[model samples]
Target: MNIKFKNFIWGVITLSVISSCDISDNKDVNPADSFLRIYDSHQFDHEIRPVDVTQTADNGYLFLGNYRRDDVDFLGTYISSVDEEGHFIRNTYLRDNNVHPVGKFLVLGGEHYFISMDAVSLQAYLNQVDDSARVVSTIGIGTTYPMYAENDGEDQFVLLSYSSVNRTTVLSLVNADGSITSQSAFGIGAGQEVEEPIIDHFTRTGRELPFFAGRSVDGTYYANGFYNYTLSLLFTDLSDNTPSGVIQGQLDQGGISSLLSLSGDNYAVARFNYGDQYANAIATLNTSGISSSTDIEGNPMLEWAYDEKVKMTTMTLGNADYIIIATTTKNQQIALHFYDNTGAYIAVDYLGFSSPYQLGAIQVTSDNGLAILGSTQVAGKFQRLCLFKKSESELNDLVQ
Candidate 1:
């Protein structure tokens, strides 16, 4: 109810309504129409939860998710700016008067990054915004849990903080006016608590040099079940903290939900799970070190054939070498798996929303198209915001 982006772009000419059932059709009629549901709305009074949607070098569309503010007791996490037809060009709310900002929101370059966590006061903030929403800077980086931020391009940024009280891995480097130019920690075990260290894909193998692929662990493996874990290969030097080489291994069973950095050399691709079943794992390292064994393409049991109750959550690397895997099954359907770059098995698309949709955040759109943010539900009573877009000939026919 406190939405503003110049009053929702001047109230979109008196709120242009278009909700008369077809539910935004085009669920796949081909002709270059690979599953279309362009912009569906559930209004917006309290729930419009989109947690991250980027692409706005003027082509428009920027959204960070969370809503629900009747004075704010809990639901308030947002940063929106839309236009490529999805309308709603301005919306910002990270709340304060007492604090209750959740977490995760990244847009990079044109700026807009977030990392808030205060479930009742665990306290954490590392916000930044600019592109008219203006906040420009804010940092406190302390009590972190779901952390992973990237943009080693020029203005510098790479947060990755996972410290379960000494189970190490800090690596800060954030500048562009937000400060902190070196933080470094990296250890991996003593108290262990690294769970889901994402970033999953970042390129550039020479000029403009950049590199990052993610997956970190040592603890919280299903509360302490599978042990031996390690998946690294971080060669950095986007202009400082020196790490021109690093390659480690030992997963011995499976448990790495995401990591991608293919073609630029030290090969990377991981969306793991052997105990809980999910698959699409591939790892490589140069200067001759780690050689890997877990491609799952030849059907090593489909690496557990999914439905282990939805949770392979994110992985991207496409543009001819393709390798996109986004899972959330158990009938909640959001699957999409295409492989290549040596893993084979190039096509699989499943989008069929319903049953409390849950596929939180995913990006890759410099024309290679794909921008998904999650949270859905309506007839059963309210909960909105589930942005969408997918085209590149429907991700190349779901990986041809």
Candidate 2:
């Protein structure tokens, strides 16, 4: 969940933890006749933008994202599939015209995958979607932000990117019809090499990168990006893709849009805490660092503090454990925030109006309630695609 915007010089746009988990028994079903669903793409100036959501294989509700067509110069990547009240049965557009898409959406064993980045071979594809969302295969990855991926069995998978030729931070091991069986590259300190060390000019000066990837409960394969803007963490070795350590700066500021693993070497970060403005927090890392942190108070974050923008995620309902966040509201609506998992403070919902909304991911449906994909600003200037549900006693009655 890393939803940020402001880079339309026409271009460039870009979860974890477990254990003690058994929070499902709310089979009380009866609150989804339509809990706020809107896939309006606003009639014609098309511009979809949700980045993830899952629960299919019969339970229906997929929704990946990326779209464009304010009348022509198209761009694509979308997959819809709703039901369980949110409507919309099938919607497709996997790779069209100038297909420039990448929004790391996943769902392993039961199928439906995502990761794209190729506008004339900038290479890094890996598509797979059926059950109506079409495009059953795509595969091409010589490297470049596969964005994020994970699934180590039942056919194998693991792809996360950043490697403009070894600038470090790469991993590939696909297969389940997307072959690539093995590959690796990583860097941050010691000798500067993934088996070749020193590549001068300060290690190719590629501005180290990595978006997000996870798996740890002894299986390793962690990654969180940022280099010339600090924030780092890398640890790989899923049997062979070596490179065992690198954990720089522990978020000196911003740059960790989301990451979760929470149970052993604990993890759960959602960043953007510019010291004294644009605040947004939710920390609980491990590997010897941040033990707790929370900041996401009311008044749209301390009264607009500095034009905010945040997006976070984490779910579970019956026995409880949540952390949703999604900020930026003070008339320009879109504020959600529902902590639990010991941090307490259970609810707060306020969605769009006066145009200007942006939440990118949050899912936990199939009766337990809460599905909120993003992008909204209707009629007053297009920009549609918004789905918002909320049940389970209307989100625990906002902590009653």
Candidate 3:
């Protein structure tokens, strides 16, 4: 066990304190100032699980998650704004009646926003929020549904949709103002295909997936979608959906699970099959032809259960760049694996004890620390949202 992990486990059980019950109890569980903040909803039959988190321009934090009630038909969304020290801000409009889950929270030009779905029409919407965490505006991009959405590291965002009628995956490059700049569609023929994405999960039909569509560091567009019936990363010309390169995978059973662009043509990728997961420190996907991802080689060939979610994120400190791979271990703890810019493995750190804490999203904070968002259960049953921040000094120690 890591020294940091050992100290944290003991600190949480013996030193942390909780006080003042409201909608959420803000507790500093560790005396060392490293503590877990659990945002609990005392209301019965309600559940909250964090989906995404991001830092605001004012140095505050905004976390979005799936908030659901047994009374509702589908899962709704909620956002909570907190200052740097974990003090609660006002109740944000993000917890309103019509919020959608399964979208990334983003900050651009100092503004906060994300994607949502209209429950009545099944229409997709882009929501821009104010500093106080209220909805400034919600714009529908004249689209019926949204299967996946991501910011392309540019001002524009890439969007994905499934058309059962045409049996195609619709791809669109959208601007910040909720308008489509370019659009294309790709998939296999209807009758010969395997399945149709659990019939678009939000429609109460089928299963959901780990989806992505964005641009590389070189600004070329790419997506993890069904390219000829297998879930592969498609390097495409945005206007035509023409594949210049394809990182191939097995039919519906295996594929790229997570991807983070490190540099031009070099990506930190995570791939998985039925029971095991692997990582590649550097994957060059800019060239043409099909590259199979069945046996990607790297450290931490973790045994993955069905509920585990894999994600990759990168950050730089001083002159060294670091790529972080985060996932839930089989022993039921979140692990963060560090790697150098050249994809060389470094060290591993762990978080969470006493109870099961699932990792949802990880972000490099403005001060070069880490902000982790996840969910945990109280009384071993009800679900609630939890957040914790790792200090910059701690991160610096890992890469040493």
Off by over 4 Å in 3: 1-34, 69-73, 90-99, 191-196, 203-207
Instruction: Identify the superior model by lDDT, candidate 1 or candidate 3.
Output: 3
Instruction: Show how many residue pairs clash in every candidate, following the order shown.
Output: 3, 5, 2
Best by TM-score: 3
Clashing pairs in 2: 16-260, 16-261, 17-260, 17-261, 17-262
Q: Write candidate 2's Cα lDDT for 233-350 as tens digits.
A: 6566645544455455433343444555656655545444453333223343444332212332222246332323355666676667777766555455677777776555566878
Worst window of 10 by summed lDDT in candidate 3? 1-10
For 241-298, candidate 1 gives per-residue lDDT tens digits of: 3344444433323433344544344233443444444344345434223333343222
TM-score of 3: 0.85
Task: List lDDT for all candidates, in order.
Answer: 0.46, 0.56, 0.68
Residue 339, model 2, lDDT = 70
Compose the digit string of candidate 3's lDDT tens values, residues 145-228: 566677765577788765555667677888788888888787744454454553444543444566677777787777777768
